[model samples]
Target chain A: MTANPKGGRYRAWGLIVPTGVLYAVTFGIPMAMLLSASFARFEAGRTTPGFFLDNYTRIASDGVTLQVFWNTVTLSAQITAVGLVVAFPVAMLMRRAGPGMRLALMFVLVSPLLTSIIVRNVAWMLILGRSGLINTWLMDWGLISSPLALMYNRLGVIIAVVHVYLPFAVLPIYAALRAIDPARENAAASLGAPPWRVFVHITLPLAMPGVVAAFTLLFILSMGVYLTPVILGGNFVVTLPMMITDVARNQYNWPFASAMSVLLLASIVVVVALASALNRAFSPPRND
Target chain B: MTERSGSPFGYAMLAIFGALVAAFLLLPLVILCIQSFTAESFLSFPPPSYGTRWYRHVAAAANWREAALSSLVIAAIVTPLSLVLGTLAALGLDRGPMRGRGVLYGILISPMILPHIVLGLGIFRIALDLHIDDSLLSIVPAHLTITVPFVVISVGASLQSFDTGLEKAAQSLGASPLRALWHITLPIIRPGLVGGGIFAFIMSFDEFIITYFLSVQTRTLPLEIFSTLRYQVSPAIAAVSALTIAFSAALTVALMMRGQVISAGRIVR
Candidate 1:
């Protein structure tokens, strides 16, 4: 609606064309290929040249795949829940802290985001190994007689996933908390509401958008996360990403892998779609 | 804000909790630094003897050096490519009164939501069909798929907040459109561009899953470390990890000193 939008359209095209072409070749076309390949027939570790529903049939009929799918959903839900709980208090402190303390906390909190997940997992293995740091410390304190199985299990993966993705949850909630006016909380307290009551009634509802946004992000990221689970969950723990890789590489079943990939992508899309619908229905509007 | 935070009990709780979270976050980096100094090679909780032996071992590994160099070269290529492309797209979104802008913007950033393995596998399939999978050239596109979305999001944020009146004023004063952009628009958006570029570089440097599918002739440091850990880890693995952590910390400090938040981080803003 601005003046000279004709020129604007031409300018936009010039600026956008190169990236468009690049993505067309790299991402757009590849996605099309993925979809097409998913429905292609599979034979002897190679994709044949026609459409088939064998992949879908197998995915539906195989009880183990269903179990693994449920397991993945459960683990991701657990990680999102735990990460949100742990991140809430920290985000509150970050919002309320003085400048110096805030900067220090931000640096520490953001460090893990910058550090490679590989290194994080490697260090987790070192700390969670049978005779690792936790065991050594417990022994020193006479807390336990034998080392515990901490790494290469479901519990370890959950812990490490939470650590890696914690910041993702905290930052959004912190931003929301920071954006809240202090006057509202102060007014509530001045009107005789207790501190806890002020927080529960005023602050929590206002920060719900951020909480939802954070959960959505964490859930999606958890769905795609491969390295954390691979490093910590070992062989038995098969998330979709891991399973996709196994079918593609180890089994040399590209079509089946493509099918799984499509399923994973669809699941995440569905999650966000459903969440946003709920968000639209439930979230209070901001007049600002 | 005043009464509660001033109370000793509240202050103590917040401070202690903050410190505990920081320690939890840095626990791995701290442990890696310690492990790199251990003299023994078999991996023990406490070092039998503390020395620079593992660091020295890492210094001598030719493959490790090559992997590091390859990573740098790829990141060097990816950063500028992503920055230019991303900035332009952001510019378009900012300046153009185009229809379906939302649709266009969504398409531009959809790769961010796509799973890495899916993108990698899809790109790999295409590359294999094109017979380009055996070259380092092929992997750059794969890396870009992941990094470009970050650039668009970051640079787009900066562009959205930029004032357009200055550029219009420059144009009225006889400055060319490109000139106004160069002299006014670009400078204002420099922080965004720089932040996007840094993110593009780091993401490319650390990317392994995409490279895993696409890498045939070249290997990056993360790929090397992954294999090393998966098959057999030497004490040198610890050293390599420590060195990368040091690099990340130094980069972080440099950005912090300049007061730049590198807003392109996947962490929600």
Candidate 2:
């Protein structure tokens, strides 16, 4: 690469200044405000500006909030787990498919992600609601006498979340699967190891990086989910973000909401750190 | 190496599993599209009759029209603003001094992963204190925080594969920097630009949570659909949802036709 003239270096940096300024105004200042507000006190249904750990303390002792937090964590884990199971086979298929087949598979997966979350959830409501497709078909076929309690529950939320996040799970695993040298598996096969054994020993270990990455990504996204729970869960299921929104919007408890937001952000940080540590622990030793 | 993919049994299992997963992905959208054509008032599978009555209803509703207009206006503003900002940030990251590049890149892209509800809560507080809560003044900036990351990442992907030699050659021939960039660099990165632009537009259009926090009198298309869905399971919503699906599907096709403008991996990453 040719060295740019001295003036060009500064110009290159200058290009970033606009975005930096935008972030400062939009993201940076607001986050700072949120952090400070989390320390403020709320009493008698009014928020007073001052330093207090009351909000954080409430998160621990208030009892209801932490349950919802745990519920959110459990739901996120469930979605991530289910997503990995379904996505693994699809990723494997993508790795083996021809270019045309791969593109078609990518289209099916990515199109859902690009579609509006509300639209996708609405579609799910039509498919899973009382008079929706599955129920109607079941009743018509005499398979059941009544509609299943499919929508408006944890199961519906999991199904919808998993559907949306499946692509997130598949792509990374597929990338990792493609990155693997087939020769390793072939070598294992030539040594008289069966296909499933080779997969267990070679493919699964090699694909761990992508699997971990997908889990991290899915869990993070699932934790932040607000609309899916509201729409698909019929507001019967409350996640962390749903609680934060309810507090801030309906209750007007800005400090409490801000505190919850901080907690959510902290949990995300922990997840990221844990995932990276796990990635390091599970990584195969490099040969080169 | 290629012949060692197990027996026909394994292939059959994978194929069956893959097809099932694909069906799972497409079933909702396909069902919604079919349900949108129902002539009946409420949602039901295998709709009693097929017609465009809901489409007519959506077209006739003033609130739907207004929300769609507001979304378009906001997306119209957000698209160009974010594209310019994101491209500049991406360019700086690619060509700038090689110090803290990773940190800077992470910071720029952090908005993508940061929970929208948290960001919405922060923006809501600030907007309320400023008394600009329900206006474009607050909403536009909120949209920018999220959409800019897509542009940065997508454009950054393009810039990574870009060759600097052509620009250097143009400069050596006495072209000014701006002239060389306009004539050489812009065309080469057009695919990224197009992809990033569509991404920004769609994101701003579909954004719900932050807009929900910021808007009281103002409603975007998704907000309208959400409110409607919350209160009533109307067939008109199916029509609106169908339109949105079509909008995304058409744009996705455009990206595909643009020939590897952005991959699902790059976008997800």
Candidate 3:
């Protein structure tokens, strides 16, 4: 049955109208314009509207673009993988802790998220710099006579990116683990299954949805990461966002930059779709 | 679940994981705080001497002050506007029997999932075409696109759990629709609205990409910090970072506290 008796549907329509107009003007039109701009040419302080495929062709053939594509994919995957491994057990521990301890841990875990990305990257720059804490501590302990190059490298970029995005991984996994009844694990244990076996066969599978969600979230975030790589990678590594920035803002090549952004968007959508499909395929069968 | 009194390995593993995660999260913020006290003019770690010179410098720098002010002003404007608009949208969508509601909601929330860099570029091009480029007005609309979805989700969740029967009862008691909404419905959802608005404010304040693109004449705090990092690494930036961190952390704590109070009230009821 319908909730409203009168033909007062116009009241709801009235409320939606303002928001719809704003969304259309701000989001919808621009997104469509961006798609069209990817195919047009911009030169000599003028944009020539046309159906040109040259921008996409350049992206396909360019070595830098290919490297950026691969780098973006691999880096996103690596961060998602590493973050899950680190976050899962921590979330489990958080689940079992007392209320005070859980709150304290949550605070600590989410503290990094509160800071600006620029600040977080700078902090990493200090810690991972040549004469930074890690190198200094290593030298004092006689682990190495020379300071290792930690900052402005791929390893450093991954470390910093993971640091910033870890909360995204932790929070979802923590929520999922909390939802799983502890009694299920106890039941498995009472049925003579070992702890490791129970975790592997039951708990891990149940938490797969969380894993998928975290992976998708982290992967998407990592793909668009600009500041971390710009700060930590120095002139060494370049991601798609950095490339897009250089092309669009620095060089004023709107068409080429639009093309690259469109490619990045398409790739992100494809990855997310694949993830959803995989999650559905592996999801536990429902008992009716 | 009783605490297990066995397995030293379990306790050791827990301790190690907790310590590592804490270190990973806190190290950067702590290091940034420490570096702000460095005596040198450059970004030299393990400074020979410690002082608050950078804090003084940050206090005096006009550009830094201007950027911080612009960020505050923009966030102040964007937060409340987005909240009202978002709440209206959520209420309408939740109450209505609109066709393709799921699809419409997905479309509405799509902005959150779209990359900021792309949005930044789109807005950059749009503003240029519209001749509104490099203005504070431009930044507000861009911030709204990101903030509105958050308000919709949070407020919509609250609305879903609310009892509409109360509204009907109020109507039977001769209360007008507007009056019922004002006196009854709005109070019940106030917590969610506040929480969501705070979330939106924090997101806009910490936003970097959109501001970096859309802003040319005006710089937000994040844009200023980004520019400084490119030319010179200094302790003043760290001080700014520390300030932003403290502000956001306070807001987060307040939101979480409000959440606890609301849930506790639910339990009592």
Candidate 4:
């Protein structure tokens, strides 16, 4: 047992064993259990555990639930799209800035992420409040006579969430942009490719991987977000998380909540798999 | 190359967008700070007169003090625990001979991807089964699910770039494996640990869902602010929010500075 090559390997395994056990018990088993609980029925504080289709059937039949699902997908897609458009130019500017300006811009972008989500939501509430900043400014400027309904709506939730998640969107794109070789752009220019053409044909394609990664991250995050919707959307908008909350807490339907969670988890897995597949499809094959 | 002028239009567009984003980012904190100085009790935007009354009120509240204390205590415990566990996991995966290491890594990091509401529900059910629902002990473990992944990623990134030959050299010099790790590896990786620990601390401190679901008797600062926001819209809430924002900003700046120093040191070395 003294200093054998295999003995060192065993030692490493020994170090990892405890953590592996913790992850297995804490995360792995519980996730499997949750998946199973989804198909069962919980009624009157008693869960009848079995394979049942009613829960899935209920999800399909409920119009409001369907609408909420659609809203979640559409909102997530819209946010990802809009986030990319807004972040691209900013990232370009960031890439072109001096050292001090770059640091300042990074801080400005990252500060929103540092602020508590609840605080950001409250800020949105105040801004979208009838007498809050947006409406007040609009009214004062004679843009509109009456206060617009901004708070406790889908639009407000989207605005707040976009603001909250913009940093995530910006940083990745900025990294991708910065990683592009400036010399290549110059070469392309010398080869008679104009600035816009070089950007479209070369830079944008190189940065596509980051765009995909950012979109996937943002979309999944937006799908599962709880606080922004709860605070800003009120009862007007119902996403998957809100539905889960209603089922688990208000209705005391643990099985229903579990069902919703399973659906959410499955969709996320599907999205991630699709993203990876797309990435592989788009990635250039290595000679090695 | 043709003489091309600066695009004033582009600059103006960037400037205006930057200003709007800055306002969106900073106005809430500003409003909260100003409201904290208002003499009036309500959460009015424009204060008739300025005073430090709300700060006094926030400081005077025993519940606020207790919540803040609990938050500090929880963050203190959770941050170190997450750093150790996360670092060990990252190191083990980085160096281990495990089969399907990629899949294992994915599983390790999956907690971050899972909807926290789901995590909350799963943990709540488990806590109920274990009969530790609403205890600080239960809440600490729940927060670990979120914070540990951040630590893992940060530590893993550093570990990926770490030089292994130094450790081997120390081992060849008759230093015990543990001593080599302590003297060689630990110092090199200390910055990652510090940065990851700061992230873990913030994650624990600002956590709302797990604490909201798990804790029965103890409420962290975020939970307090959450409940306050839900039930009322007071200048006091604004004041508390302002303080939390400032605290978070300070921590972030400190972490960024530490990261810069570490990277600069790495470059110099």
The DockQ leader among the candidates is 2
Q: Residues A184-209, candidate 3, lDDT per residue (tens digit)?
A: 77777777887678778777887777
The numbered model that scores best in lDDT is 2
lDDT of 4 by residue, A170-193 (tens): 777777777776766677777888
Best prediction by TM-score:
2
Off by over 4 Å in 4: A284-288, B1-20, B230-232, B260-269
Task: Encode model 1's per-residue lDDT on A179-265: one tens digit a residue.
Answer: 787877787888888767877888888887788888888888898888889988887578888888888877878888888888888
Clashes of 1: 0
Runs off by more than 4 Å, candidate 1: A1-5, A285-288, B1-12, B231-233, B262-267
lDDT for each candidate structure: 0.81, 0.88, 0.79, 0.75
In the range B65-166, model 1's lDDT, one tens digit per residue, is 899999999999998999888888888877666577888888998887777888888998999899998576678888887888878888888887889899
lDDT of 1: 0.81
Candidate 2: tens digits of C-alpha lDDT, residues B204-246: 9999999999999998999998888764579889999899898
Candidate 2: segments with Cα more than 4 A from true spot: A1-7, B261-264
Candidate 3: where is the Cα deviation over 4 Å? A1-6, A42-46, B1-12, B39-49, B260-269
lDDT of 1 at A87: 84
- What TM-score does the first chain of candidate 1 have? 0.93
**Of all true interface contacts, what fraction is found in model 1?**
0.49
Candidate 4 root-mean-square deviation in Å: 3.6
Which candidate, 1 or 3, would have the higher DockQ against the true structure? 1
lDDT digits (tens) for residues A136-239 of candidate 2 = 89999999998998979999999999987898899889889989988888989989999999999999999999999999999999999999889988768988
